[model samples]
Target: MARRRASNEELAGLVQGEQTDAVRRLEDRVAARVLGDLESRFAVLSQRSITAWVAAFGSVQAESGDTAALRRILSTIRGAVRRLLGPLGPRAQRELDQALTDAVLLGARQHAAFVEEATGRATRPVSGRPSRGLRRRAAAIGAAIADRRDRALAILRPSRARRWSDVQAGIGAAQSALPATRAHIATTVNEAVNEASLTAIDHQGAQKLWIAERDACVNCAAYSGMVVAADADFPAGLSWDPNQRGRGKALAAPPKHPHCRCRVTAWEEGWAPEGVPSFPDSLRREARRSIARGWSLPTESGAARIRAARELLRTGAGLPKSVEEFAALAVRAGRFTDRTVPTGP
Candidate 1:
């Protein structure tokens, strides 16, 4: 007996899963390079600052020091920050460019393999150059890092400083830059894949479908499994309403918002995979459930969450008991959008 061959769906799942893993690994690599460099630089700066201050003021923990000496030390640290960290943007851009090239190439390869498997023909190769959208995002993130460093330096500047505690507070404020950089790295990687998918779709003349993670935000959920032509834009406006009455501009691919994990895959008629009820239908159902359950609605905006919860209530759809309770409570008391709301298994 011969071994069984996997169906188109199985093959697609295998390849797509591999691509997802590749994207993650690329993201980790870029982040490690950029962030590890940042951490090391900060560590060196911190150590040198301590050593300098201790040498001049007798101790880094001193409550008060010679005023002119403290000013001079602070000035030196400012110069050091500019000298040591000023190149961060250019360095990060280099990392982003390289990682995006790899990500795009991998996407192109997987997509070509899938197309060949589905239709037994080879498609054109995708360019590995980062798309303009991706470049813009990278530049923005790099600029933000530099801006944060500058702001941190501003805070570290002596303005009638009385204690080392104040210096510590400034450093703490500066550390806020790290989290946003981490999120941006994820966003940039996802966008790179999205760009590649779009290019592959163009090369193969295949339709593309938006794929949202199961626990995706309401906005991303709205696009889950939505199929569109290669040249067409997914309809604009991201709203939680089942009808999706949003006013935002149309999008070309995944990353409906910052830090979005949504993706896209090629779609064609008669290639629907086996063992799933219906991919598009399932995604639509999940979106409905997300709205009804108030899952991932406006984590950053309390007012938006309350509005979304209220809209869900007004839709006349049957909300789960807990969702109804919390939606009502949230509407009654405009708060707690970030609170953990259960998403059913």
Candidate 2:
């Protein structure tokens, strides 16, 4: 028997799993590079300091170490760290850029293939070139890495120390800082990769997209089954950023926060599984409720207005009628106005 093809949902899950692995591998690579550099620099600095101390005191023991020589050694180590920052920042950025480019292209191709399989429509491959958004995100991550490195150096710098134990304690502190930095790199880079992929699919002509939550927590669970137009902004009320509430521009797309595991996928009409909320059905219900209630659309908040427009569109009547038109009509009539809505092909 011929093997049955995987369903679209299954394909989406597979894509999410693969991308997660890719992100983890990229994180490991970056962490290794950073820790390796730190170790090598510290080794060099330690060797030079030991030699200088012996020459100054005519002995290699910590008891023979002169205070002035110790200060000079600390200065030298700090200088080396500063010099390392120049090269390290660019190297980390280059890694992030390449990783994000690979991830976006992979996601775009996978989504396009799935769409073609389900809809019998062809999709062009996304270019591997880095996007402006990707570049900006990479630069931000690079700056963060530099800042963390500087902080780590500060924590690791030994105070007026005459013994090896004091220096070792500082080194221990530096090592302790790496775990948090590694976590930060992973989450930030993963978010950038996901955003890039979503942008790629949007540019490829997806008309609608749905959120695919993975092991969702309470916050993301509320977004489950939500669908929106390809180009429409997510409802402001659903924004993860508190400052973005009521602001239409806060989150234009999915994976709204750092380390958000939710994947946004192309949505096909009539393809949602049972129990999944259909956008049209939900919109119609909202419209009916709004009409039944004496709610002022014009005075309603932005979130309310968006909800009203979506409802109007679902009733097969709101076409050519923008959100503003719907709000104005609601204000004039104090009720929902029924009109013929244009259906998409």
What local distance difference test score does each model get? 0.68, 0.52
* 24 Cα displacement, candidate 1 (Å): 2.0
Q: Per-residue CA lDDT of candidate 1, range 164-192, in tens?
A: 66665555545656666777888887888
The worst-scoring run of ten residues by lDDT in candidate 1 lies at 1-10
lDDT of 1 at 206: 80
Each candidate: how many clashes?
0, 3
Could you give me the TM-score of model 1 versus the true structure? 0.70
The sequence of per-residue lDDT tens digits that candidate 2 reaches over residues 109-219 is: 655555554445565655555568657866675576567556646644545355554544444444444454555556555555556556655775554454433333223
Deviation of model 2 at 69, angstroms: 6.8
Give candidate 1's root-mean-square deviation (CA, Å).
5.7
TM-score winner: 1
